[model samples]
Target: MTKLTRTLALSIFALAAGTAGAMPRPMDAGRVIMSDTADRDVAIDTSTRWVNVTNGQTVRFDVGGQRFTFVFDAWPSTDSVPLSAIAPKGVTVPDVRVYIAPNPLYQD
Candidate 1:
Protein backbone atom coordinates (compact mmCIF):
# COMPACT_ATOMS: atom_id res chain seq x y z
CA MET A 1 0.00 0.00 0.00
CA THR A 2 1.14 3.55 -0.65
CA LYS A 3 2.59 5.45 2.36
CA LEU A 4 -0.13 8.11 2.07
CA THR A 5 -2.93 5.51 2.06
CA ARG A 6 -1.45 3.71 5.10
CA THR A 7 -1.17 6.96 7.01
CA LEU A 8 -4.79 7.91 6.26
CA ALA A 9 -6.04 4.50 7.40
CA LEU A 10 -4.10 4.74 10.65
CA SER A 11 -5.43 8.23 11.28
CA ILE A 12 -9.02 7.02 10.85
CA PHE A 13 -8.39 4.14 13.27
CA ALA A 14 -6.94 6.50 15.88
CA LEU A 15 -9.88 8.88 15.54
CA ALA A 16 -12.38 6.05 16.01
CA ALA A 17 -10.54 4.74 19.07
CA GLY A 18 -10.44 8.16 20.69
CA THR A 19 -14.12 8.83 20.04
CA ALA A 20 -15.19 5.41 21.34
CA GLY A 21 -13.41 6.10 24.62
CA ALA A 22 -14.91 9.56 24.88
CA MET A 23 -18.48 8.31 24.50
CA PRO A 24 -20.10 7.74 27.89
CA ARG A 25 -21.57 4.42 28.75
CA PRO A 26 -25.33 4.25 29.09
CA MET A 27 -26.24 5.04 32.71
CA ASP A 28 -27.37 2.19 34.85
CA ALA A 29 -31.14 1.70 35.07
CA GLY A 30 -30.51 4.14 37.93
CA ARG A 31 -27.97 5.07 40.57
CA VAL A 32 -27.16 3.02 43.70
CA ILE A 33 -26.34 4.81 46.93
CA MET A 34 -25.14 2.61 49.76
CA SER A 35 -26.75 4.00 52.92
CA ASP A 36 -25.18 2.29 55.90
CA THR A 37 -27.37 4.58 58.07
CA ALA A 38 -24.45 5.45 60.33
CA ASP A 39 -22.77 7.93 58.06
CA ARG A 40 -25.07 10.19 56.06
CA ASP A 41 -22.81 9.64 53.08
CA VAL A 42 -24.41 9.65 49.65
CA ALA A 43 -23.30 8.27 46.31
CA ILE A 44 -25.04 9.35 43.20
CA ASP A 45 -24.71 9.20 39.43
CA THR A 46 -25.72 12.51 37.91
CA SER A 47 -26.71 10.85 34.68
CA THR A 48 -29.87 9.13 35.98
CA ARG A 49 -32.66 10.03 38.40
CA TRP A 50 -33.97 6.55 39.13
CA VAL A 51 -33.47 4.92 42.53
CA ASN A 52 -33.47 1.26 43.49
CA VAL A 53 -33.91 -0.36 46.90
CA THR A 54 -33.99 -3.90 48.15
CA ASN A 55 -36.04 -5.70 50.77
CA GLY A 56 -35.51 -4.74 54.43
CA GLN A 57 -34.16 -1.47 53.14
CA THR A 58 -35.51 1.94 54.08
CA VAL A 59 -35.36 4.99 51.89
CA ARG A 60 -36.60 8.35 53.01
CA PHE A 61 -36.86 11.72 51.37
CA ASP A 62 -38.43 14.92 52.63
CA VAL A 63 -40.10 17.22 50.22
CA GLY A 64 -42.59 20.05 50.61
CA GLY A 65 -43.00 19.62 54.37
CA GLN A 66 -43.76 15.94 53.88
CA ARG A 67 -41.65 12.86 54.41
CA PHE A 68 -41.88 9.68 52.39
CA THR A 69 -40.58 6.30 53.49
CA PHE A 70 -40.23 3.33 51.16
CA VAL A 71 -40.10 -0.13 52.76
CA PHE A 72 -39.47 -2.99 50.43
CA ASP A 73 -40.75 -6.48 51.08
CA ALA A 74 -38.48 -9.46 51.66
CA TRP A 75 -39.63 -10.96 48.38
CA PRO A 76 -41.33 -9.73 45.26
CA SER A 77 -38.60 -7.10 45.25
CA THR A 78 -38.48 -4.34 42.77
CA ASP A 79 -35.14 -4.85 41.08
CA SER A 80 -35.13 -1.34 39.68
CA VAL A 81 -37.86 1.27 39.62
CA PRO A 82 -37.81 4.92 38.71
CA LEU A 83 -37.80 7.34 41.62
CA SER A 84 -40.95 8.92 40.28
CA ALA A 85 -42.83 5.64 40.71
CA ILE A 86 -42.56 5.87 44.51
CA ALA A 87 -42.26 9.58 45.05
CA PRO A 88 -45.41 11.60 45.71
CA LYS A 89 -47.42 12.35 42.63
CA GLY A 90 -46.14 15.36 40.70
CA VAL A 91 -42.84 15.23 42.60
CA THR A 92 -39.94 15.41 40.21
CA VAL A 93 -37.18 12.83 40.69
CA PRO A 94 -34.42 15.35 40.09
CA ASP A 95 -35.62 17.53 42.96
CA VAL A 96 -35.51 14.73 45.50
CA ARG A 97 -32.52 13.06 47.18
CA VAL A 98 -32.57 9.29 46.82
CA TYR A 99 -31.15 7.26 49.71
CA ILE A 100 -30.61 3.53 49.46
CA ALA A 101 -29.38 1.29 52.26
CA PRO A 102 -26.79 -1.43 51.86
CA ASN A 103 -28.39 -4.65 50.69
CA PRO A 104 -28.30 -7.12 47.85
CA LEU A 105 -28.62 -4.32 45.28
CA TYR A 106 -26.56 -5.38 42.27
CA GLN A 107 -24.36 -3.22 40.08
CA ASP A 108 -23.35 -3.82 36.53
Candidate 2:
Protein backbone atom coordinates (compact mmCIF):
# COMPACT_ATOMS: atom_id res chain seq x y z
CA MET A 1 0.00 0.00 0.00
CA THR A 2 1.12 3.61 -0.62
CA LYS A 3 2.42 5.62 2.36
CA LEU A 4 -0.57 8.04 2.46
CA THR A 5 -3.14 5.23 2.08
CA ARG A 6 -1.44 3.23 4.84
CA THR A 7 -1.46 6.24 7.20
CA LEU A 8 -5.18 6.88 6.58
CA ALA A 9 -6.07 3.22 7.14
CA LEU A 10 -4.11 3.10 10.41
CA SER A 11 -5.78 6.31 11.64
CA ILE A 12 -9.23 4.90 10.87
CA PHE A 13 -8.42 1.68 12.68
CA ALA A 14 -7.14 3.55 15.73
CA LEU A 15 -10.27 5.72 15.83
CA ALA A 16 -12.53 2.70 15.58
CA ALA A 17 -10.66 0.89 18.35
CA GLY A 18 -10.81 3.91 20.64
CA THR A 19 -14.50 4.34 20.02
CA ALA A 20 -15.18 0.71 20.81
CA GLY A 21 -13.19 0.94 24.01
CA ALA A 22 -15.02 4.07 25.10
CA MET A 23 -18.44 2.51 24.67
CA PRO A 24 -20.47 2.63 27.88
CA ARG A 25 -21.72 -0.53 29.56
CA PRO A 26 -25.15 -0.99 31.11
CA MET A 27 -25.04 -0.36 34.88
CA ASP A 28 -27.47 -1.44 37.57
CA ALA A 29 -29.47 1.43 39.01
CA GLY A 30 -29.91 1.70 42.80
CA ARG A 31 -29.52 4.17 45.64
CA VAL A 32 -26.19 4.03 47.53
CA ILE A 33 -26.34 4.70 51.28
CA MET A 34 -23.13 5.14 53.23
CA SER A 35 -23.11 4.83 57.01
CA ASP A 36 -20.82 6.29 59.62
CA THR A 37 -18.93 4.36 62.28
CA ALA A 38 -21.55 5.00 64.93
CA ASP A 39 -24.54 2.68 65.13
CA ARG A 40 -27.81 4.26 64.12
CA ASP A 41 -31.14 3.48 62.58
CA VAL A 42 -31.96 4.69 59.06
CA ALA A 43 -35.38 4.75 57.53
CA ILE A 44 -35.48 3.53 53.95
CA ASP A 45 -38.88 3.24 52.41
CA THR A 46 -37.53 2.53 48.96
CA SER A 47 -37.63 -1.08 47.83
CA THR A 48 -34.30 -1.06 45.97
CA ARG A 49 -31.06 0.32 47.37
CA TRP A 50 -27.43 -0.59 48.13
CA VAL A 51 -25.89 -0.06 51.54
CA ASN A 52 -22.14 0.29 52.04
CA VAL A 53 -21.41 -0.40 55.67
CA THR A 54 -18.02 0.18 57.20
CA ASN A 55 -16.45 -1.76 60.05
CA GLY A 56 -18.06 -1.14 63.46
CA GLN A 57 -21.01 0.42 61.73
CA THR A 58 -24.48 -0.89 62.34
CA VAL A 59 -27.24 0.18 60.01
CA ARG A 60 -30.90 -0.44 60.70
CA PHE A 61 -33.22 -0.28 57.74
CA ASP A 62 -36.91 0.43 58.20
CA VAL A 63 -38.44 -1.04 55.07
CA GLY A 64 -42.16 -0.74 54.53
CA GLY A 65 -42.58 0.48 58.11
CA GLN A 66 -40.82 -2.63 59.47
CA ARG A 67 -37.37 -2.40 60.98
CA PHE A 68 -34.47 -4.67 60.02
CA THR A 69 -30.96 -4.09 61.27
CA PHE A 70 -27.76 -5.58 59.82
CA VAL A 71 -24.44 -5.36 61.62
CA PHE A 72 -21.18 -5.52 59.73
CA ASP A 73 -19.50 -8.76 60.80
CA ALA A 74 -16.21 -8.15 59.05
CA TRP A 75 -13.88 -5.56 60.42
CA PRO A 76 -11.31 -3.39 58.54
CA SER A 77 -13.22 -3.86 55.28
CA THR A 78 -16.40 -2.32 54.00
CA ASP A 79 -19.21 -4.70 53.07
CA SER A 80 -21.54 -4.38 50.12
CA VAL A 81 -25.06 -5.05 51.43
CA PRO A 82 -27.52 -5.72 48.69
CA LEU A 83 -31.30 -5.61 49.09
CA SER A 84 -31.49 -9.36 49.61
CA ALA A 85 -29.72 -9.17 52.97
CA ILE A 86 -32.62 -7.30 54.48
CA ALA A 87 -35.35 -8.98 52.44
CA PRO A 88 -35.56 -11.99 54.72
CA LYS A 89 -35.96 -9.79 57.76
CA GLY A 90 -38.83 -7.59 56.59
CA VAL A 91 -38.08 -5.70 53.38
CA THR A 92 -40.51 -6.63 50.65
CA VAL A 93 -39.34 -7.07 47.09
CA PRO A 94 -38.81 -9.63 44.36
CA ASP A 95 -36.88 -12.63 45.74
CA VAL A 96 -33.49 -12.12 44.11
CA ARG A 97 -29.92 -11.82 45.28
CA VAL A 98 -27.72 -9.35 43.38
CA TYR A 99 -24.15 -9.19 44.57
CA ILE A 100 -22.09 -6.45 42.95
CA ALA A 101 -18.34 -6.77 42.99
CA PRO A 102 -15.33 -6.05 40.81
CA ASN A 103 -15.81 -7.95 37.59
CA PRO A 104 -13.08 -10.59 37.58
CA LEU A 105 -13.67 -11.15 33.86
CA TYR A 106 -12.84 -7.52 33.07
CA GLN A 107 -9.76 -6.85 30.94
CA ASP A 108 -7.93 -3.62 30.56
Candidate 3:
Protein backbone atom coordinates (compact mmCIF):
# COMPACT_ATOMS: atom_id res chain seq x y z
CA MET A 1 0.00 0.00 0.00
CA THR A 2 1.10 3.62 -0.60
CA LYS A 3 2.46 5.63 2.36
CA LEU A 4 -0.57 8.00 2.29
CA THR A 5 -3.09 5.11 2.31
CA ARG A 6 -1.31 3.34 5.17
CA THR A 7 -1.33 6.51 7.27
CA LEU A 8 -5.03 7.05 6.59
CA ALA A 9 -5.93 3.53 7.62
CA LEU A 10 -3.93 3.82 10.82
CA SER A 11 -5.67 7.09 11.72
CA ILE A 12 -9.10 5.52 11.21
CA PHE A 13 -8.20 2.52 13.36
CA ALA A 14 -6.95 4.77 16.16
CA LEU A 15 -10.10 6.85 16.10
CA ALA A 16 -12.31 3.79 16.26
CA ALA A 17 -10.38 2.33 19.19
CA GLY A 18 -10.52 5.59 21.12
CA THR A 19 -14.26 5.95 20.59
CA ALA A 20 -14.96 2.41 21.72
CA GLY A 21 -12.75 2.77 24.79
CA ALA A 22 -14.54 5.97 25.89
CA MET A 23 -17.91 4.36 26.48
CA PRO A 24 -19.48 5.15 29.88
CA ARG A 25 -19.35 2.58 32.66
CA PRO A 26 -22.51 1.01 34.07
CA MET A 27 -23.72 1.56 37.66
CA ASP A 28 -24.45 -1.02 40.40
CA ALA A 29 -26.61 0.69 43.01
CA GLY A 30 -27.38 4.30 44.00
CA ARG A 31 -29.98 6.94 44.70
CA VAL A 32 -31.98 9.06 42.28
CA ILE A 33 -33.12 12.38 43.69
CA MET A 34 -35.90 14.61 42.38
CA SER A 35 -37.95 17.63 43.35
CA ASP A 36 -41.68 17.97 43.66
CA THR A 37 -43.93 20.83 42.57
CA ALA A 38 -43.57 22.20 46.09
CA ASP A 39 -39.81 21.60 45.78
CA ARG A 40 -39.89 18.74 48.26
CA ASP A 41 -36.95 16.36 48.08
CA VAL A 42 -37.40 12.74 47.02
CA ALA A 43 -34.85 9.97 46.62
CA ILE A 44 -34.78 6.28 45.69
CA ASP A 45 -32.11 3.82 46.71
CA THR A 46 -31.27 0.80 44.61
CA SER A 47 -28.80 -0.68 47.07
CA THR A 48 -31.02 -3.69 47.56
CA ARG A 49 -30.48 -4.65 43.94
CA TRP A 50 -34.19 -4.12 43.17
CA VAL A 51 -36.40 -1.24 42.18
CA ASN A 52 -38.49 0.37 44.94
CA VAL A 53 -41.92 1.84 44.55
CA THR A 54 -44.24 3.95 46.68
CA ASN A 55 -47.79 5.31 46.71
CA GLY A 56 -49.24 3.36 43.84
CA GLN A 57 -46.22 4.01 41.67
CA THR A 58 -44.51 1.53 39.39
CA VAL A 59 -40.98 0.21 39.76
CA ARG A 60 -39.13 -1.19 36.78
CA PHE A 61 -35.55 -2.30 36.24
CA ASP A 62 -33.52 -4.48 33.87
CA VAL A 63 -30.66 -6.18 35.64
CA GLY A 64 -28.49 -9.31 35.49
CA GLY A 65 -30.59 -12.45 35.03
CA GLN A 66 -33.85 -11.02 36.42
CA ARG A 67 -36.41 -8.77 34.83
CA PHE A 68 -37.43 -6.57 37.78
CA THR A 69 -40.98 -5.37 38.31
CA PHE A 70 -42.69 -3.92 41.37
CA VAL A 71 -45.77 -2.05 42.62
CA PHE A 72 -46.00 0.00 45.79
CA ASP A 73 -49.76 0.16 45.78
CA ALA A 74 -49.85 -3.20 47.53
CA TRP A 75 -48.38 -1.60 50.59
CA PRO A 76 -50.19 0.71 52.94
CA SER A 77 -50.85 4.23 51.72
CA THR A 78 -47.97 5.48 53.86
CA ASP A 79 -45.56 2.76 52.77
CA SER A 80 -43.15 2.19 49.91
CA VAL A 81 -41.64 -0.96 48.49
CA PRO A 82 -38.02 -1.67 49.18
CA LEU A 83 -35.56 -2.10 46.32
CA SER A 84 -33.90 -5.16 47.82
CA ALA A 85 -36.97 -7.22 46.98
CA ILE A 86 -36.90 -6.44 43.28
CA ALA A 87 -33.42 -5.54 42.13
CA PRO A 88 -31.37 -8.06 40.17
CA LYS A 89 -28.27 -9.80 41.47
CA GLY A 90 -24.97 -7.93 41.05
CA VAL A 91 -26.61 -5.23 38.95
CA THR A 92 -25.69 -1.63 39.64
CA VAL A 93 -28.33 1.00 40.08
CA PRO A 94 -27.79 4.26 38.21
CA ASP A 95 -28.61 7.64 39.77
CA VAL A 96 -29.93 8.94 36.49
CA ARG A 97 -33.58 10.04 36.13
CA VAL A 98 -34.34 7.56 33.36
CA TYR A 99 -37.66 6.35 34.75
CA ILE A 100 -41.01 8.18 35.00
CA ALA A 101 -43.28 8.12 38.06
CA PRO A 102 -46.51 9.98 38.78
CA ASN A 103 -45.66 9.99 42.45
CA PRO A 104 -42.22 9.98 44.06
CA LEU A 105 -41.26 9.10 47.60
CA TYR A 106 -38.03 9.49 49.52
CA GLN A 107 -36.45 6.58 51.33
CA ASP A 108 -34.63 6.76 54.61
What is the per-residue lDDT of model 1 for residues 5-64, given as tens digits with 9 covering 90 to 100? 999999999999999745222132222233434222223334545444544555554444
Candidate order by lDDT, highest to lowest?
A: 2, 1, 3
lDDT of each: 0.45, 0.47, 0.40
Supply the TM-score for candidate 3. Answer: 0.26
Give the C-alpha lDDT of model 2: 0.47
lDDT, candidate 2, 1-108, per-residue tens: 999999999999999998974422211222224434436665554454544444434566566576555544432222243455444433574433333333234425
Clashes of each: 0, 0, 7
* Model with the higher TM-score, candidate 2 or 3: 2
Task: Give the candidate order by descending TM-score.
Answer: 2, 1, 3
Which number leads on TM-score? 2
Which ranges in model 3 have alpha carbons more than 4 Å from their true place?
Answer: 1-53, 77-81, 86-108
What is the alpha-carbon RMSD of candidate 3 to the true structure?
Answer: 13.7
Worst 10 residues of 1 by lDDT: 23-32
Clashing pairs in 1: none
The residue pairs found clashing in candidate 2 are: none
Task: For residues 1-45, write the lDDT of model 3, one tens digit per residue.
Answer: 999999999999999999984522112222222322222223445
Please give each candidate's TM-score: 0.34, 0.39, 0.26
Q: What lDDT is reached at residue 105 by model 1?
A: 54
